[model samples]
Target chain A: DAGVTQSPTHLIKTRGQQVTLRCSPKSGHDTVSWYQQALGQGPQFIFQYYEEEERQRGNFPDRFSGHQFPNYSSELNVNALLLGDSALYLCASSLNGGVYGYTFGSGTRLTVV
Target chain B: GQQVMQIPQYQHVQEGEDFTTYCNSSTTLSNIQWYKQRPGGHPVFLIQLVKSGEVKKQKRLTFQFGEAKKNSSLHITATQTTDVGTYFCAGPYLSSNTGKLIFGQGTTLQVKP
Candidate 1:
């Protein structure tokens, strides 16, 4: 089965601009979550979506937002991007809140200049 | 906020040597999970430990959950070049059903052949 799929394997954006990254959850999964990973750092939780509604969020700023479609696809939007925003954005999917485990995508590398 | 901390931020060893990374959580975790991210790759699920003092093995890698449910460890026996990557330990923040995870800073391993 196809696992979680993310769009734009790599991207470059200017500071103060905006960016949108997309993700398609793995087949048979219903929940989607987003994470940010900097160089030499672990993935940090951003937010989670279930039933098209954001269920929980981490300590990210309001400039970071996300959406989950009815089909279980997700999009992460970052506004007013800064150089620090440059990192790998990962999308993970799970079945029934991921009590078992999570399936992660290849992730999108965002580079802000 | 809950936090997961890992020790020995980096490790380099010969292919025939062994390596282990430790993780500790500030709060009790319902379960702990292990993930491995190859260089320039997204994190992949390794395994999960739930019960207290639980242990699981996968090939040459072994995972352990302490009796207090707040610590974990990953050990590799006779590491190989393929084992070069960052290993992370994560725990669900509050409830497993929330789909929120707190991940450690990760332990990067380099295996020299």
Candidate 2:
């Protein structure tokens, strides 16, 4: 199993609602990044956090925002979610933003109805 | 804009057969990373290549980075049931190498024993 830990292995939500997903980095890790994986597609980078700050972001809108805590844990918040938002959310952790390769969590499956 | 692309979206191979997936990047990459995801599991880090014309091996799997640093490949010497999964290649954006990866579409491998 991946050393990283994530919460709410699965979730069902309605369109227009908001959702929050949490993640805890693996032991001794400090960088956390999030990805959204759609069915039959590759994972898409959302953003990355380092030292409790957002280091970089992807093409996603501001509605898909995230925060990293001092302990290297992170939260992904999506507002006004749409049906297209339904996908598997994956969390990966590493030292220096995956320069050493990333360790991923089981992921949270979000379904928007 | 940075992008990564993978070919042979799906491959079905018999046990003991060989398998290969190719990845290409829109821009030169400092390094390339490989990952594998099971049918219903999150992606797991497989390996990373840094130097040009570099190759690394792990048992039955072999990874190679191109001299141009814009292409890479993962080759399996002998496919096994346990090797069934989707393999992905990711690279940091050339504009911002702060650890945010631009992932490829990935290639799914189905190994029948």
Candidate 3:
């Protein structure tokens, strides 16, 4: 069975623009979470979605929002992105309520130029 | 705010040597998970420890959870070149409204042959 998958392995965006990254969770997984990882740093939690609703959120601003579809696929949207937004956007999927181990996608690298 | 920190920002070891990384949390955690990220790759789930003073092993890797539930460690015996990557420890911090997983700065390991 295929594991978690993310689209557009790499993306480049300009300041003030917007970008959307997609992720398809592992089969049978119900919860999806997003994280941002800067170079040489650990992944920072962005938010988590469960049952097609945002169950939890991190310290990210409203500029960073996300949606999880009924199929358990998720999309992370960034509005008026800034250079600081340049990082690796990672998608992680977990079973139940995210209290278990997570399967992560290769992540989408976003470069703001 | 809950936070996690890792020691020895980076380590370089020759193949067949041993290595260890420590993770500490500012607050108690219900569970802790570990992941490994290779250069230019996504983070992969390694293991999870829940009970305090718990210990588990996967082949050459040993995982431990502190008695206080606020610290963890990952130890690798006889490292190999294939083990080069950054190891991250993460745990969830529960709040009234939302719960988020916080990741440590990570321990980057370089295994040279």
- TM-scores for all candidates: the values are 0.97, 0.97, 0.96
> lDDT by residue for model 1 over B43-108, one digit each (tens)?
899998999999999999999999999999999999999999999999998736457899999999
Off by over 4 Å in 1: none
The sequence of per-residue lDDT tens digits that candidate 2 reaches over residues A1-113 is 58899999999999999999999999999999999999989888899999988988888999999999989999999999999999999999998667788899999999999
In candidate 3, clashing pairs total: 0
TM-score of chain B for predicted candidate 1: 0.97
User: Worst 10-residue stretch by lDDT in candidate 2 chain B?
Assistant: B93-102
**What TM-score does candidate 3 get on C-alpha atoms?**
0.96
CA lDDT, candidate 1, residue B3 = 88
Task: Give the per-residue Cα lDDT of candidate 3 at B15.
Answer: 97
User: Candidate 2, residues B1-113: lDDT per residue as tens digits?
Assistant: 77899999999999999999999999999999999999999899999899999999999999999999999999999898999999999998872445788889999999888
Clashing pairs in 2: none
Separate DockQ for every predicted complex = 0.82, 0.80, 0.63
lDDT score, candidate 2: 0.92
TM-score, prediction 2: 0.97
Candidates sorted by lDDT, best first = 1, 2, 3
- Could you tell me the lDDT of residue B51 within candidate 3? 87
